[model samples]
Target chain A: MNLIFWSSESDDDRRDTQVGSWLGELDPGRDDATYWMRFHRDVVDGSRFELARRRQAAELTVVGVVSSWSRTLVPVALAAAAAAGIMLAQPRLDQVEPPILVEDVLTMGLGDPMPALFVDDEEGGLLLASEIY
Target chain B: MTSHQKIEDPRFGDGELVRRAREGEEEAYALLVGRYMRPAYLVALSVTRRHEDAEDAAQEAFLVALQRLEECRDPERFGGWLMTIVRNRSRNLLRRESLRETSVLPETAKSGEPLPDRVTERSELDETLQAALAELTPVQREVVLLHDLEGWKHREIAERLDLPSGTVRSHLHFARKALRGKLEGVLTDHVKG
Candidate 1:
């Protein structure tokens, strides 16, 4: 005859009961509880440590790479961009001029009053203005 | 040493390890990893099934947890926090792979015996648990494995998974019921023989 017991129980309790119940029915002739004990041992031994370590190492390596890349690349990229901007702006700085350009213009066109926007007394600039009017 | 002392003692517990780790103690983090690696991998393997996949998920989870360790609110509950990372990574991997066609693989029983009247050993129990876990919805399986294997309480699980306590309880209930039903049938058949 076969009968099953079902109940809502805590896991640890269920685990213990399940182990006991399953083994009780086995009826192995040996006086030793080796089989039952081994069952518990095997359940406890389900953990695999070596593979887990290797996996952890591989993961740390990946994280190290990503973190280093971000830390190094971001600043380097920003500095490189800043350097490029300074290099590109160098020629533009030379285009700025002082008031000396007005002096040069006066030197070239001083004899021509209308062109220079000033009237020279030696050229009768005031008379020429009166005659044109 | 007592497991309770190991888990609950503030000076020697996972929370202490996290506090030390956050303070730049690399050894503390390493110890924490050593302590939780098996359970973490088991949870991942429960979801992914394949060793390689589980390893990837487990590693990624740890790395993520390490990177964001500062964000953990209660360092005393480090195990629960790390476990959440494991489940999240596993779920994300599963989602990414969901588009591809895949089928649940059968467990390799100890012998070539047929289904009815088959003896279930402890190794078989582990394998059966893995297979049944794989067959569950990711969320359900995660809650179940965390509760059963890792011995996490419902509130701890809910906090880690960012789920409602009621939802965690319901998932646990359903998963336990399903697994029990499956195992009961197999055991009853074997007893009849």
Candidate 2:
């Protein structure tokens, strides 16, 4: 019953099965061996594997050396140069400007500092010394 | 240990080899190269048909495999992963050659020994098979080579190719059918000759 049920296979299945049988009957010793052996001994040997290997090794080495050199040396060298440059230019930066202060603003309002007073308005705010008529 | 025991692969039954390779064991990679280099080269040659191109593709494949070993989802499935790299590299090499040779040879001339051996009937069979294989589209050729020549199972082939098993089945079916037809045609000619 099971065989009967499985028997109605498609044309593709039948064809594939036949091919599979042919594939099974193929002697690996005679044809495949000769072709593979010849291909390996002759063609593969003549290829550019050696050149590629050397190139790969050189590329890796250069990358590694450059990476390490950059990691350790570049930062230290840059930092030292920057520090030296700043040391050389310190006085120039210092003489550029003095910061603003509260005393500077107060002196501007008082006009030679006669005496100072203050008052407050109901709506807005505080009035400064000269306006305290 | 007995010779039988000693003949057992040092890297077998342990994922340690993969771990070591990941940790930069060039020797472990060398061991892998020693193992797969021949088969990989053969596959490359079969696909590209050029001696120089095959060797370059095989070496590039091995290098790529080593570099991308971390992407190997299953450490034990390393061989299949390596084969995928070989296939991809060989295809890339062939594509480049095709582009370069387009102006020179409009039809990409396969690079095997052009003369068929006349001595043995078996050699004729090989020649026929080789020619038939060459006639296949690259996808069909790849599927046939992976499944028939390399002895990979459908599931394995599907996974390696990142295709569904059903698609792999369809490809294999068509490839084998095409090959059988080609072989039958050649056989008829050879018999006449």
Q: Over the full model, what C-alpha lDDT does candidate 1 score relative to the true structure?
A: 0.60
Residues B37-150 of candidate 1 have per-residue lDDT tens digits of 655765676677655566678777777776677788899778778887887798788877664323432343334444332343445544554555555676776666566655
Q: What tier of docking accuracy does candidate 2 attain?
A: incorrect
For each candidate, report its DockQ versus the true two-chain complex: 0.04, 0.04
Relative to the true interface, what fraction of contacts does candidate 2 keep?
0.03
Off by over 4 Å in 1: A1-133, B1-10, B13-15, B95-131, B187-193
